[model samples]
Target: MAGPLPDGDQAPVDGLLSLEEIKGSEARTFHAYVHIPFCKDICGYCDFNTYTATQLGSLKQSDYAASLISEIRFSAQALEQSKLLPRKFSTVFFGGGTPSLLPAADLIEILSSLEQTFGFTENAEITTEANPDTVTFEKFAALRQAGFNRVSIGMQSGVQSVLDTLERSHNPENVFKAFEIVKGLGFGTSLDLIFGAPGESLEQWRESLEAAIALEPDHLSAYSLIVEPGTKLARQIKSGELAEPDEDLQAEKYELTEQLLSAAGYTWYEISNWSKSESLQSDHNLAYWMGQDWWGYGPGAHSHLGSVRWWNQKHPLSYSKKLEDKISPAVGRELLSIDTAKLERVMLESRTSKGMSISDLEQLEAGAKSRIPQLIADGLIDGQLAIKGRLVLTLRGRLLADAVVRELTD
Candidate 1:
């Protein structure tokens, strides 16, 4: 249930802050995650709530932008009132089906509203996800002017064949061009590369790695392909037209990625993300991995706050109507009890290099402690130290993070 509304703010749920409070709290030192649900086309392997060009066009980008701004204004006020922290934002992220497709002017308007509603830190890290085909130098320049200091290009792979197999519109050359343009705009840049696509060879993967490294991005995110249920790729795999990479091959590829990127001076801050410098790391994502609360906006965007997680309707039509009515567009929600919160913190912390604080762990069910030593002995986790208050995951532990977290919570 939502909390009571404060004066002059949107009505709040029983436990969550009022919409106005969310805005004010946003102004403080926290992360802002805005979602853009439009994409040129949804990839077979993708399952995130996304719409193709046809659906996006019908949704009216201008109208949606206006609604999004209103949402921003509301959250900014709520954040300031919540007083989560004394400082301004540490990071802001524009992620989505394809944030790059939005015009620079729209992005600028959003950024300006963010600044006016909730102040940004002097050196705030603002990042937007970009696809190669949609990028242009002029757009990038406008993005830089709009206060975006970081650009994350979704390269997926540098091999044209691999790109085609993944149903990506852009070729390797397009990726390169996008990266060069973003870099020339003076923003810190990162690349997203994936391994274990159907029919990809180890040599081809290595070449992809080499190509990505040649671009000299400040950060890199290498993810192994995952076959989630209900995705088109999963259906193809079931139909025998697609083959998931064998475990052994995928493991080898993973090792190769670690070796190559580390040799190139990138530090593995998390399981999938690597940064050339500590400062180049993605603060917004780290916040999520560390179990901090964040707001998510846009059709089908998800949010988590104080153990209350919620998501909006996925269909653009439904989302547009809700936004026009000035109502909170939540379509689903889960309210966690105190025990669940403790369990979540423990589970989430295990996935990152930063382990959970013992004090926080003590808050978990007493029976959960008996499993800790076994996990540590089995090389599934390391002992506690106080980085952010207690112990964190060791490099080896990170490999089996999800299973270990499940064990702790179960």
Candidate 2:
């Protein structure tokens, strides 16, 4: 389970979208996200909306696919009724509490429904997140045949001690086997790594990086561990059972990550993401940063269209019940104002290697344009890129990304 949802206006039962909300929606690239909320075991550090077998009281894993399909059909109908121009899905990502835990047949069924509702673009990317221990060769083959072209494995760490501290149930060796399976199936492979665990040392982080690099994944995302409040990891640290992660040590590990991955020919696209080439970057993630339209379906899933943002009910039962009654599962929504939308665009685009356009920033406010020179002088943004009309972050800027955002937005 995760924390409470943010405050917002109540959503309509019919899931109707105002004309203002759907205006120009066709021009934006559309994507679909299916959130699987079931997990075999909950990680101590996880705060994502996820549930164990016992936690899901009335929701059976066997019937989960059917429920998701209903939402897909409902979404298509809502968009049609809104008179939003129909567009094929550019990418579909199945993320969650361990999407691989479901039967391959179930995953295939859900994806088939999406296609039948709204066809996919040519060579559109379809990806699913897998727990290394939960995937098999047969499963990968089935998924690949069903049009899932990518698999992101949750490798977490290469060291067993760090794995234990994180409460990850998968064996480290399973990661190697899983990687082999996906690669053999011709799926675009990605491995996710978490550094800065409480007990994790710099050397341990290095070993994890080296292990992942040796596997030669097409895309790799290495994220620093964040101990969200109310998580088991946070409680352990509070009780002195685990030492809190040191900020200085985390910085050192981040620098090492940039060094080794760069040496291996992986370019940093987003601050936390690296890829062997530009084509290998995760297009689904980029869609979000670029302010494109996407509908996230499942418990606690969030969706955005034009300037309107909404989230579904957090509990599986509540989400399923709403859909069962032929109603939208969304619990709340917020419509963004023009200025707020522009500010958000700057905030998100700033984290990417492509950088935000200076013209867009200048539109936010008068002082925003003037901040560029001082930012370059302070060694935060690239002076060369600024001269070319883009605000790109240097290494220091990446580390202090929040301050950089404040400098321009304030």
Candidate 3:
């Protein structure tokens, strides 16, 4: 289970957007995110909106696809009624508790509904996040046939002990097999790694990184483990049954990650993501960082269009009931003020390789502009890039990214 949803203005039942809220949407890239909130077993460290079979009393997993399709059609009607121009989706991403838990046919059906409603752009990127154990060769093949071009496998750790500590359900060996299946089907493959587990060692982290690299994945994301409040992992640490992650050790591991991945020919495009080349970057994720419009369908999913952002009901049952009644599942929404939107743009873009423009910062706050020279002097930003009008982070800056954002925003 996740934390409570943020407070905001109540969303309209018809799901209609104001013309002012959607103005200029035609000029922005559009995307779709389908959230699958089912999981075979909830991981101890996860705080995402997810539910196991036991937790969902009356919600049948078999009926989930149909519910999502209803939302898709409803979204189209809402946008049309709002008088927003129809735009093809440039990317579609299926993320969840474990998207691979659903039957491939269900995924295909939901995707077909999306295509039938708004269509897709030429060369559109479609991706899904899969747990290694839940996927098979036939599954990947079927998805490929249905037009999914990318797959991100959850390969949290190569070491059995680390996986055990995280309470991951997949066998370590299954990751390589899943990767082989997806790659053989001509899908762009990505592997996810997590470091800084409660008891993880530098050597164990190295082994995980090496294992992912050996597969020669097109893209990789290395994330530090965060034990959110109310999660099982957090409880264990609170009870002193498990040691908390050491920030110093995590910093050391990050530096090791940069060193090894760079040596293996991967370039960091964002603070936590790397790719073999620019073409292999995760465009769907980049859309979020770049502030493009995307409609998120499914329980607990969040969507952003122009200046407005909204999230659906968190529980699957609550989400489905609203759709069944021909209402938007969105419980609340917020219209971002100009200052809020600009600050967000700075906060997100500053973490990417295509760093924030210096002029934009100056416009946001003159003090932010003054902080640039101090940032460069402290080895937190690339001096040459600053001279060239962008605030690109140095390696050290990436490790202290939140601090960098504070300096600029303050």
Q: Candidate 3: which stretches are off by over 4 Å?
A: none
Q: CA lDDT of each candidate?
A: 0.76, 0.92, 0.94
TM-score of each: 0.87, 0.99, 0.99
Clashing residue pairs in candidate 3 (N, C-alpha, C atoms within 3 angstroms): none
User: After superposition, which runs of candidate 2 have C-alpha atoms over 4 Å from their true positions?
Assistant: none
lDDT of 1 by residue, 166-209 (tens): 99989999998899899988999999998999999999899999
**What is the C-alpha lDDT profile of model 3 across 110-144, one tens digit per residue?**
99999989999999999999999988989889999
The whole-model C-alpha lDDT of candidate 2 against the native structure comes to 0.92
Q: For residues 1-410, could you state the per-residue lDDT of candidate 2 as single tens digits?
A: 25788789998988889898887688899999999998998999999999999998867999889889999999999988888888999999999989999999999999999999899999899999999999899988999999999999999999999999999988789999999999999999999999999989999999999999999999999999998999999999999999999988988998999999999999998899999999999999999999999999999999999779999999889998999999999999999888788878888999999998898788776679888899899899999998999999998898889899988888
Each prediction's number of clashing residue pairs: 29, 0, 0
- Estimate the lDDT of model 3: 0.94
